[model samples]
Structures are given as structure tokens and as C-alpha cells.
Target: MLGEPAAMTENTGDTPRTLRLRADDNVAIVVNAFGLPAGTVFADGLTLLEFVPQGHKVALVDIPQGGTVVRYGEVVGIALRPLPRGSWVEESSVETPVAPDLDALEKATRVPAPLPPLDGYTFEGYRNPDGSVGTKNILAISISVQCVAGTLDVAIRRIKQELLPRYPNVDDVVGLTHAYGCGVAINAPEAVIPIRTLQSLARNPNFGGEVMVVGLGCEKLVSERLLPAGDVAADTGVVRLQDERHAGFGMMLDSIMTMAEARLEVLNRRTRETCPAADLVVGLQCGGSDAFSGVTANPALGHAADLLVRCGATVLFSEVTEVRDAIHLLTPRAASPEIADALIREMAWYDDYLAKGGADRRANPSPGNKKGGLNNIVEKALGSVAKSGTSAITGVLAPGERVRDKGLIFAATPASDFVCGTLQLASGITLQVFSTGRGTPYGLAHAPVIKVATRTELAERWSDLIDLDAGRIATGHATIEEMGEELFRLILDVASGHKQPWSDRWGLFNDLTLFNPAPIT
Candidate 1:
């Protein structure tokens, strides 16, 4: 009766956790932590007519035929008829009707729609040679091939310790080592040639003027060897990976120091200016989401995203599957018929991917989200979409497309945070505003990731990880507006070369550029 408290506990199986929705209702809502069959009966005085999977709802009390199902202390939907005492609630689920699926009638409720003005707001950001800004002046070491990447990484580690006693502004000297960059035909030139080695490491706005890159001179990708005379070659050091095994490594270290010394002298020239919000491209993301996400953190960020859009900044929000269940909310937001069609195409792709994996997002989710009370993808997407903050859908993006227009952008990704982060960075995102309801250490490589926490306990416990506390909305200490503004300032600091909540203290700067998509085939 202790572990098997189906008679007492809200869900059956593991730990002693139970929940009651109504005071007047009888019989307990039994959550089966384990998958017991339709006819399985527990020793704790409870029997199961059908199994209730984890993160799905169950009956807290017996319901008469046609009775209402209450959740969040409100009538979510009507029970699809009668249920026996102490039986798991199945088939019946919460479904709110909508007129349009992507850009539709979501404002039927009394809550006001987002209508922030587009005036007097801007982020003073730089547009580089490749149309990106260098938020921080970084000195980096990149290897065009993985074979000699170890030598470069080993040398960089030693150099960090060697220079730590001198260069305080030298944020981090890291190695951008990856599996690709070679083994492909370099002679075959196309419209968008393979510049994987140069772009992610060199063009990444975080790195300043001078840098070092070592290459194997003979790999199939020998573009690092082909150079426009006197420009990139004048400052770059490209040594053959096969160099006498020892002279190459020594020359690389010497080149790094030479570049570092030159970059240090110009650190004084960095300045912050008031650039228009049009220059800013904010990326919207949510991880470790919970039941309270739509009610709190996600919507708060959505408002902030709307503010940026109103000020002329383009906001890019990813994770298509997370929003698949909330298709009804996006119906009215789509600006035209084509955008709605594109949105539907991406959703169908996500469903196909899920089917290939043999799992539905509703039936399976990350364990952390389940622990935080999320039911399914529908509920998750409904709450997740709230982060867009009600801005009009000016544009939508494919997996790695750069967001060219301002407004709310529904971008697609593979749902891996690290991979998604890389794709967004490569797609030209200047910064990423990530909100986590439960808790997460996820961040993007090469771009600034501002983490907002949704719970007060998580905020206090892991203050170092959380930059903004949306949890105050949950506890009544701060309004969403206050938190939204706070997050905005944090974004400005990050764009102005200020340290992130953790990076300022720990001196950690990430330069991860992962491209998971097939190479433009």
C-alpha cells in the first residue's frame, strides 16, 4: 500500500506525489508512473480500466456521464461521458476551438493584443564585412581540418594560461575544431561554396580584427589555401598540416601571439552607440518548459519580442514541433496566404520526423518538462507560443535562412538546443533570448544567450545561470513589463560587448558553430 498508493496518490507508480483538482470531487486521480495495462489492479485499493501515460491527465475523482473536466481550477472541457470510480481518464483531452490555425483568432479572450509602437528605439550595432556585428573583440584559433585541430587546441590552451597574467580583455582564446571543413571536393565551385571553416570561426562577429587559422593545405577543401592576394593572407597564418610535425605547431603559436598583441592595442576603440532597433535581430527560444510557461515566462518574453518588433527589430523564434499543437493560436498572425502555407509545410515535416522516430511529442517529452507539470505538445505549444508576445508574422524562415525582415519570425530547427543555436548563429542571429521554466545550461556558440528563469526557487538556487527572473510573475513580486525591460537592458549589454550573467564573472565565451543540415545539396 505504501509504494502502490493508487488508492491515495494522484498517479500510480513511483514516488509519493499526488494532486487533487476539485474539493467536491470523489475518488482519487491515479497517475500510473509505470505502464500497467487496462485491466491491471494495484494492491493499494485502486484498479485501472485503462493506462494513463506519463505527462497525460488522469481522473482525480469519478465523473458522472457528461460531467466537466476541471484543470488549472477551470472547466477545460467536458468528459466524453461516464467513468467508473478510481479509473484512469482516457480519450477526453482539452481542446480550445480556433478560426485560423497559424494566423487566426487567438484574441477572443479578454487579454489585450500586443501593439507596441515603432519609434525612438534602437540598438547601436555594427555591420561587419559579412553584414554581422562584432559584439565582443575576441582572439581565436581555428583549424580548417580535424586532424590537426588537436595541435591547435593544445597550443591555444597553453597560450591561455601563458597570457592570463597579462591580457584581462582577452576574454577567451578557444579552438573551433569540427568534423567537416575537408574531405569534400574543393575544386567543385557552386553558387554558395564551402566556407564552413572561415565563416563560423572568422566572420563570427565576436572575434575582433586579427585571427589565426591552420590548415592541411592538401585536404579536398583547400579553399583555405586559395586567397585573394594581400587582404586576408597579409594577416592570416596558413601552415601545411604536414609541416615537419614540429615546426608547424611552433609557427602557429608565434602567429597567435603576434595577432593577440596587435588586437590588445586597439581594445580602447570599442564603443557603444544607440543604433535603431531595426539593426537588432533577436532570436526567441524556450527550453525546460513547464505548465506555468504560457501563464508566465513564455508570454513575458513574447511581450519583449513584440517590443523589439515594434521598434523595428526582427525576432526569430524556432522549435516548430513545440508550436505544432498550438496551430490555432497562430492563424490570425500570418500576414498572407503564402506565409500560412509555409508554416503548414514546416509543421507537416515535423510530424513526419516524429513518425519516423515512432514517438509523438504528446506521448513523450523531456523528463524535466514532465516534472514541471507539462501535459503534451498541444499544451506545451500553447504556452510556448506566448513567448512571441503577439507580434504580426512579417516573415518565416527555413532551417538556416537569415531573418531578413522585421516582426515575429517562425523559424524551423531540429529541436536540439546546441545544434539549433549553431544554425541560428549561422543564419545571422546577433543574440538569442532563451527562457527556461524548469532550468537549463543550454546556450548558443559564438552568440550571446540571455537565460530567463521561470521559478523563484530556481532563480535563487542557480542565480549564476539565470539572467532574468520571469518567476517573479509566478510569485507576484514583479510584473512582466519590469522583467521584460530588465531583459532588454541585458540584451543591450550583451550587444555592447558586456559580459553575460555567467560570462562576466567566469570569462567563458562560446564559439560553437554547428551546422546540422545537409550541405546545400
Candidate 2:
């Protein structure tokens, strides 16, 4: 028999190396640097029956075949065979539970209690012509086809070296490049996904609605389709590389440079003005996840998400497959029956999408995810959902659609970290909070990503890289509430440009990947 749950102590170089989440859980995760060998006794008198790797599960009590294996107060899996006490619970020993049927899910059954309004929080942001607010003032150059990327890159480098210094208010020049725009079925019904993605990304709030387009002039995706209402101004809004008026390649580059300078002149006049927190649009995501993800970092970030919702800000949580196993857990939190239906639509669409590829949710929980102790998609989904906090889902966005309301929204996207981040950026997130238990150096060019660590070990190992250490909560040094409050303040400060996250400081950024479900010909 196991003893009662006791308060965990701080790391004093000789502390216990296990973590039990709940009193009823049948297993605990190994927290030691190297796992303990067989016969190692925990304080509760439970002895290890075998050598378990770090972050792997240790069975707490004897489990009969087909018995439930509980963790985080829910059944994560079922034992495939008799699991004796102290046995290592690897993926092979447990079987994933069947995903809940969409038709059986309840609607608005677990609505979150409205939190008291958070007042007076404000940030200095660039206000856009479309009424959206931007955390950074950047001049984005949109390209219609992949062919113009090389040319655009050269122009961007020159802009950064020469014109950028001239317009001090402009942050940096970004080429909105992608693999789409030609050599595909552009008019196919499914092609709308990537088409809208490029269109909306061009109008990202951080660009301040000052649009510019570069086209190869022969691509299927024309400049008119890429820009909004074909609204590019005559002076400097467009440059066509194939136009005959250009004498040579040098003229083409010079034409791009001239158009860029005109946009810079317009963007340089903009300044940051005080805006209420309600104007904020935040993207929430996770990568390189581990078991501690739910226990510390994600929960704390969820709390901050709830706080942001209370203050009337828009918070978007995405990654379709990451949430597929936990669809039942979210539908009840939907703000209305219509919202619940929208959630189901996104999930069902993804399921069909996967079936066409002859794949399923098992494709998730990457190797790093398994090394971080997530045995299957069921286990990963439970931890990933913690980032959403306890908020009613007020809206849902199809891939690449722009966000129009303020509240907790669900933006449906693939589980790939890069693709998810790109869709979120296109949906208009000004800043992002990314939690990790296994480490990643992931960053976005269009937004500031605040990397959060789930364990003290990773935080200490990569101190300069991590922005916040919610790992303190796991060590008993900080409560979830305290860590959440700190994160909320950090969001405001970072959005105000008063603080720069490591991703921003070191200029580490990943390219924008469009989610093109359409086929290539």
C-alpha cells in the first residue's frame, strides 16, 4: 500500500526523484536525471521493480489486465496485461482509449464561470487602419509566387542595410514567401485554404495594413488575388519582375528597392500609442511537450489565458490533432450550441482529411514527445489542452481566417508546430506563449514567442533561451497563481516592446509555412 501524498520539497541535491500527480493515480513519473534502478525505495515504501528511464512512468500498485491506468485525475490508458507494482509503464504495456464520438459529446455542459473583469492593463502598440493593434511596426513585402522569393530576399537584405536605418520606426522588412502561388490546382475547391492563407497573412495586424506585393507576373496566383480588393496604391504598392519596362535584372532589383523605400516612408511615420489590453490578440501553442507540461508550465499559461479573456482580449488555441483525443473535454466548454457545432465541424473535417492520407491521430506525439514521456496521442492531448485554461470557447476559426472578435477562440490547424504558428500569425496573433517540456528553439518572424520551460532542469540548462520558468511550480517554490500572475505581466510588457523575449533578442525565427490541404499537380 502507498502512503498519503505529501508536500514535495525543494531540490537540495538529494531529493526524491519522482512525481505523483494525484492520490488516486496508479503511476508516477521519474524526475531524476538518470532513472532509478530496480529495488529503489521511494519515501512511501513503494519499490521499483525495474529500471525506468527519466520522465517515464512507474506503476504505483499492482494493476490487473485491462485495468485503467490513471494519471492527472483521468484514465490515460488501460493495462494490456497484469502490471505489477513498481513496473515501468512503457507505451507497449498500455493501450490507448477510443476517441469520443462527435455525436455523443455534450454542448455547453461545462461552461466556465465568468471571471471578474481585469481592469486598467494597457500596452503601447501600433494601431492599424483596420482597427486591429500591433505589437511591432514592421513593413511586410508580400510575394505572389515562390519564384520571387530569391529576388525578395535580396531586396530585404538591402532594405535592412540601407533603408531600415533611414526609417528608425520600422522594425524590419519581411518577405511573405511560401511554396504556393503556381504549379498547383489554384481553382480547385480545396485550394481556397492556401489562397486565403496568403491573402490574410498579407494583412496581418503588425503590417499596419500598408500592403506591398511582388509578383512574377505569370504565376497562377496573381497579385490581385493576393491583395485585398486589388487595393494596392499606384505609387509603391506593387512591383512586377517580368515587366518589359525594366532594362535588366538590376532595374528589377532597383524597382523593388524603390517600392520598398516608399512603403518604409509611410511606415516610419507610425508610432506606438497606449492601447487597452482588450485590443490584444494572443496565440497559444506548445511543442516538444512532456508529462510535466500539464503539471506546471501549461497550467500556469492557461491561467494567464483565462486572465486575458477576463480582460476582453482574444486568445487562440490551436493544433487539430493535438486536441482530437480531448474533443469531449472542450465541447462542453463551448459558449453556445453553435460554437460546439463549429468545434465538431473542425474535428470531423480533420478526421476525413487524415483518412484520405491513410493516417490518423497516432501520427502525432513525435519521437521527442515520446522521449519526454508522452506514451500516445491520448496522453499528449490531455497535457496540450491545459494551455487553453478554463474559458468558454466564444468563437472558432477555420484555417487561416482572420480573427474578428475578442474572447477565447479555437483556430483549427494541423499539429505541425511551424504550420500552426503560421496559421495563428495569419489569424492575427500579436504575441504568442509556447510551452515546452522537451526543448525547442522555435520562433516566429511575425510575432514574439515567449518560450516557457516545464522543468527546472531545462530552465537551468537553457537559462538564456527560456523567458519564464513555470518549473518553479513543480518544485513547490511557486504556486500556479503566482506563476500565472507573473506571466500575465510579462505578456503586457513584451507586447509593449518594453521587454524583448529571447526569440526576438537573438533573431531566431522560423519561416511561415502555409497549410495547403489542396493537391499539387
Candidate 3:
């Protein structure tokens, strides 16, 4: 139903077109690029009493003050005052509704039936000694503290300029630098989040298990702690700037480069081999969203996510606040009671976390979102959940945790694009499908990001940046299934090195920002 065109009425060339999502809905969104002016009439004979912007909602029926305003067949908000038919329904005119009660949610009552297996889908990937596969063969240098970031950057520049050519197979070298590791309460119970994030990032399948760490000698988070469990030791791939052997900045650069070249040599020997689709880990996220996000791009992504699950690939849908208001819809689709409880636990944890910060879930639908027709977080949440594709949620991962289970997993994270992308990297997503309605240039250094546009205007405007255009679904030019199949083939092609996404081609990667909730002291 999501990918299908909304209920459309016949319209002459001069008449405006609008989309009503459900028969029971009282509002419909304007589909024209530029909104229809007041007094314009639809083919249904519904005249606009006031001007409505594109993607903005208009009341299809009269309602009294405090009446429910519905969209997607759900109560998104309440009318603040009397609204006449065909009147523009803007954000200020709607009052946010209370969130669903998490405690009363049904668990595993409506789990989706297993989709028929989609087999024989495979990709060319680097096979690591740890038995994991990699989409890109890169040597990542981890850091124990922020102090060594500058030094590491210098060394990485030299490695790229002087050493990368010798090892043609190694994709790139990255410095896994972050603001954590020092000047914080490292021993705090909450500190495990960032610590584990760094650890998990080093273990990301794309890194090829050739972990290298750079540390300043006296940091609170020592270099050894950043290493994998059984591999921690002084002699194991660590370069300490304060070591007696490093007498000056030049020596420090040499030490890192020496260690880097060794790892690069090992990585250069790796080659892409055939791997099952099950080895693929994909992350689903949406940003710069508008109302069209729910109706177009997100639903198409959801279809692709469902396809990936049927193919035995691991898929992750994240952003706790984005999913908070729609938790009721998700809980019942959990694979089991334990997983359902895990979903609730992560929600409750984030709720408490937000409360402690004197914030609530309503602190969303940014100014850009308002202009793009998102009235509030509740409406945004309903649309945001579409990326999960009705798959039974099989597991949950807290912020910064590594993903362990297969199938669909909810990787909890803050909604900020950089933060969510970083945590998803930590969760082991080899490829990410990012949907944008208002549009963004967001990308990640560690993984390939496929940008999908929700509107045809955006796709045409940013043709070089957007990898796929779901906007055609809104115009009735493409169906959700067709877009899903297109996206799925694109994913395999990109994963197998047969294609490169715009993000990777242009190197438009954003910095990784860790979600550190512990004290600064």
C-alpha cells in the first residue's frame, strides 16, 4: 500500500492534483511542484479555500476546534481551531498529540510471515581471516585519545601520497579519530557506549581486521583497550607518540607510516570473491524529510529492506526518537516476546535519556522539515517507520553496539545524521541507503551511502548526488515494487564493486561523531 499511488482523482491540465493517502483520511497533500493558489478547483470539485504549498496538507472536510487531524490513517495531531474544507493545514494550526503508551503495546501478535527465500544473490567481496567479508578493503588506524588526531592526520596524508600507489588493491586509509578517549569519566557505567563504539568500528568488516591503533602515552583510555578481545598487547599494532623511540614529530610520523604500510601490504593482497547476499549488512536511514518521504522514498526503501531480509541479508532500521511515537506498530511485528521487550527497553531508555536532558521527542521536525510539510514528530514518526518494511524485528542493538543477529534489527541511535551514521557503522553496516525529501549531501567515510530522492524536483536538481529517484512513484511513473527491484540490483552491483555510489565517487564523507552520554569530568 505504501508504494502504490495515493488515491488520485481525474484532473484536467489546468486543474491541480492532490493525493489522499487513505479513504478515511481528512487531509490530502498537494502533489504539484508549486502549490495551488486559493480558489483553484480539483477534479473532485474540492476548491482550495486558501493557498497550500507543495507537500503541505489541506483539510478535505470541515472540523471543529480540538478535532483530530488524520494522515496515513493515523491521528497525527489535533486541530487547534475550527478548520473549513480546503483550508491549508499548517504546523501552527495543529497541536501535537500525546505519544502512544509503550507499556500497553501488543508484542509479537502480528508478526509478518516469512517471505519466500530469495536465493543465489551474491556479491564480490574481500574475505577476511576472521570469516567476515568486506565491501571495501581499507586499513583503519584507531586512536586511543583525541590528542593524537593531528599526528595521525599527518601520517595518513603521507601514507596516501607515498604508499597507497604501491598497494593498488587497498581502497583507502582512514583515521578513526573521535572526541572521546580522554577528559571524560572513562570509568562511568555509561562510558561503555563510546568505548565499545571505537572497538566495534575497528572490527567493521570493511576494515579487514588489520587493526592499527595510535595513542598518546598518558591518555585515560589506553590504546590496549581499543584492541579486539584476544588481541590486546603492547606489541600488537600500536604506535605510541610518547614512546622513547619517537624523539620528534618526524619520528612520530615515521612510526605511524611504518605500521600503516605493513597493514596496507596485507590489505593489498585481498581481492573480491563471491559471497552470499546474507553477508551483506545494510543500514536504513532518512534525513531532510518532507511528507513525500513517507509516501515515496521511504516506502520504496522499505520494499528493498524486505527484499534484503528475504535474501537473508541483515538489515537495520534506526533512530530511536524517529521510531518512538510509532513503537506500537513495531512491537507487534517483533519476532518474539524477548525481542519485543528489547524494543521497548531501548525506547524506555531513550525516553529516560531525553527526560534527563530536559527534552522530549517533540524536539524534531526541524525548520527545514516544517517548510517541507512535516507538521510534528508524530507525523514524522509514522512516515519514518516505513523504512522497516513490515519485517519482523529480529533483534535490537543499543547505541554504539555491534550487530550480532541477522534479519531485521533496530539499531537504536540519536536522529542526528552524523551521529546515526557513525553508530550504524559501529553496528557493522557495509552499505547504507539514505533517503532524503528536502535533500542532503550526507555521506560516510567507512561505508558506501546510496542517496535516494523523495521528490522528482530534488532528483533533477541534484542529479549528481542522488543515486536513485523514488519521486516517480508519487507521479505514478513508477511503482514501489519496481523501485525496490531497481534499488536491490543497484545494491548488489555497488556491493560487488561493479558500481560506485556518488558519495564514494565524490568522496563526500562526513566526520564520524560518537554518541557519548557520560560525564565530561
Candidate 4:
């Protein structure tokens, strides 16, 4: 079921940025910043976009500082003061931020640009019979409903997990459990987030095949929809637990053994190879983002993101709320008018969403971020926007959607890490660069997350869980350039079948907590 893996290249030197980040504009980014700058003209090793120095000007010309700064064609923040031409654009700062300052800042983020190139890129993944790509190798046993989840988990757990040594290529073996498979209305679905989670898991590419139904049978979510039920290539077949055929848990395990064993040869048949950078679809995600997250991890990763984009890898950054302060930086890259229009629509949607007695994303910055020293959401958004680098804003998306385009893109969702990460994974990412402040163990079924931390303290505290740490930059022992290059190589290691830190190696791809959009019927 696994196809050839995606390709990788030698270190992508810093991407060149053409749009000069003038000292005067609050917004600073260029559509094309690909070459190195001469000494003194721009700071060396600063990487303003991706490895561009902090003083690099995406806009050579400038306007009054108090005037709005536009990048992707939106207002990320307002100028704290007036500015002169050729001055570096500073991100908009709020006046007594919690007061009236938010109105102007939120308007500056989530704009559009042309879609970056999408050709000549691919990751080596298992393409299910349905044509989806998976990043890892996993054996999946789907339970039809909550009724039989326990029985199936027991059957899965009883298997010799240690025996995986015989199958070095496999990522993990897991039983897909749900809080509901039965007991809920079959059609009670009304844009339920968890329902989308089930479909996401069933649709994930990391899994080799599924053998399941309710351990009892008659569950609404039978093998018919969950597994590739009748597909031979998927090496899949669905059986009901209540079926007179596969009667007991013992019998189910035996059946699973035979079913799982048959896929070993196919799973082992795959191996890693060099692919272009663009072939790698690493989800650029942040969670448990605190004030420092935007300031530290977010922008640091953005530097790497711009480098990857320049090298031609597909980078997907999500959570529209997190980018609220800098949506304007993304708009200029809009792939189409529809994408641009969708961007505007969601902007208003979020605006009205907040005005209705509910706070908008600004209030959504987590408590950890506040305690870790983030002040308010606007400041957090300003920092979070840096993760996208300086690539064009190719497309704007809502949750539970597909991304077939390239360049710098956004997938919209509330501020939950797993929710946005899962949506990006479902779209097509075998790897993810996850930055976190406080600790949380969240991993997708197939996507082997490359975890990063915002600060050095959290990095040392959770070193075992983290794959890379940019926090050292905060400590001054390391620079963003050093960290960015380190992260780029680490990405290659994960893609090459090296076991990731957060995974149990049982291939726990939980899509049960996802949110997907429904096609209009």
C-alpha cells in the first residue's frame, strides 16, 4: 500500500526575499527574496524572511509609521509611530493593547497572494486504494461503535507488540477506538466535530488496512464505510464481532494475526530515498502557544518555513486565529479570487463571531501562554504570524478541507493544536513541525510530528518528547539560523523512517478528535 517516499535535498540555503522589509512599514515581506545581500547593506545571518536578516527590507520604499503596513495585503498591526522611507517596518503595536488597539491589529492579518509552485514535489507515502497518501506504516483495526471498543482494544493489546522487530518498517499497530460508534443517532450528525474525527482516522494514509465492525455488530459505522472493505490492494476486509463467523475475542485476534501478517511483505517493501524539498509536506503548526510561542517558536519556525518554501517544499500553516495580527502578510499570494474572497469572508465571520458576546481569537490565547508570559492575544498573533515566513499567501482554507495548491497557505480553525494539525495531516502531510510552549502529548495516527519548544526551559524539561528545540536561541546559546538548519535536517531524519519522539511506535493515529467540512449535499 505504501508508495515511494517523498524526496529531500541538501540544505536549502536561505531563501532570497525581493520585498524589502523597510524600517518604516509595520508589514515586511517580499514575493521573491532568493539571493544573499551584500555586507552592511543588510545584516548577514539575520534571515528576515527565511534566513534573511532582521533588517532586510522587503519594501525599499516606506510611508508614515502610524499608517497601516500591508504585506499579504492586510493590516497585521498598526505603526506605533510615524516612519520615513527605507526604514524597517515594525509590526503594529497596540496602545494600552487591551483597549481600542485590537480593532486595527486584527484587520492586518490573513490576506492573499499567488499560490507558490505545486509541481515537482511529492513525499514517499502509502497511497491507499482511494488515492490518499500516508506518512507512516500502521496496522489499523477499526471498531464500529463504542459498544465493541473495549473488546477490540483487548484483542489488539493481546497481540505481541514486541514482535514488531520482525517488521522494522512498520511505524505502529493501533486499534481505532471511539467514544461513539453506536448509541448516537446514525444521522444525528449536524456538523459535529468528532464525527469528522472518525472519517479522518478512517481516511488517514498511515494505516495499512482495517479489519473491523462493532465487536457486537449492527453498529451504524460498520466496516462498509470504515475499512476499504472489499478492496484487495488495501489488503483489507471487514468482519463483525457479533458475526457467527468470527465469534470471540480470541477468534478476532487470530483473524487479525492472519490479516495483519499478510501485509508485512507489502509494508516491508517500501524504503526511503532522496526527494526534492517541495515533495515534503511538513505541516507548520503551533499549539499551547503562549506569548513566547509567537515571539520565539512561531517566528523561528517561520524562518525555516521560508527556507523550505524557497527550496520548493510545501509548507501548510493553519489556525486563522493565531495569524490574526498578520493576515495581511498572506493575502498577496492568493491563488485565485475565490481564495481571496474566502479570506475576506472568514475575516468578517471571525469579526462577527467576537462581537456576539463572545471574544474573538485574541482572547483565545491559552492560559499557559499568559502564564508563560504572553500578555494578550494581539501580541500573541503578531508573534504567531512570523511562522509563515515571507512566501506569498497562496490560499486560505477553513477546517476539514483539502490543499492541492502550494506556496505559503493557511488552514483556518480555532486555536486547538490537534484540531488544526489533524486537518492539515488529513489534507496530505507525512510530517509536521509542531511548536509548543506548555507540555501536551498530541500526535496524529500517521504524521510523525517533529516537536519543537518555544523556550529553553521547556526544551530541557521535555527533551524526550521534543525532536528539535529552537528555544536555545532564546538562551542565546544558539541562533535562529543554526536552529533552522538543524530543524531542516531533522525533518529528513523523520521522513527516512527514524522513529519520532512522541509516538508510542504503535502508530497511534487518532483522528477521533478532528473537524472536517461537509460537501454541500
Taking all chains together, each candidate's TM-score versus the true structure is 0.70, 0.96, 0.98, 0.68
lDDT of each: 0.59, 0.87, 0.90, 0.55
Greater-lDDT candidate between 2 and 4: 2
What does the lDDT come to for candidate 3?
0.90
Best first by TM-score, ranked: 3, 2, 1, 4
What is the per-residue lDDT of model 4 for residues 1-521, given as tens digits with 9 covering 90 to 100?
00010111112234332322223333333222222333313332223322322312233334454555443232434557654433434332322133222223233243434335434433455555554445677766666567766766665565546345677876566666655655555554434444544545555556644333334557654556555435533225555566676766678667666665666556656554445666566788877765346544666687677667766766788776765554544454455556656666666655665576466456675667654434455555666666776665666755655566666677666567766765675555667888887766777665687778876667777766766776655444566667776777677667656545564453444454444232222
Tens digit of per-residue lDDT, candidate 2, span 1-521: 01212334245565656777777888888777666789887777878889988778888889999999988767889999999999999988999988889999999988888989999999999998878999998989999999999999988898899889999999988989999899999998889889888888988889988788899889898887766785755344678888888888889889998888888888998899999999999999999998778778888888899899999999999999989888888999999999999999999999999999999788688888888789989888888888888889999999999999789999999988999999999999999999999889999878899999998889989888899998887777787778888999999999999999999999999999999988898
**138-186: candidate 3 lDDT, tens digit per residue:** 8999999999999899899999999999999999999899998889999
lDDT of 1 by residue, 197-311 (tens): 2454354556554445667666654535433234455235455556454365677566655555555445434444566766777777888886556555776787678678777
Report the number of clashing residue pairs per model.
21, 0, 0, 77
Q: RMSD for each model, in Å, please?
A: 8.7, 2.6, 1.2, 10.5
Output candidate 3 Cα RMSD.
1.2
Q: Which ten residues in a row have the lowest lDDT in candidate 2?
A: 1-10
Considering every candidate listed, which one attains the maximal TM-score?
3
Worst 10 residues of 4 by lDDT: 1-10
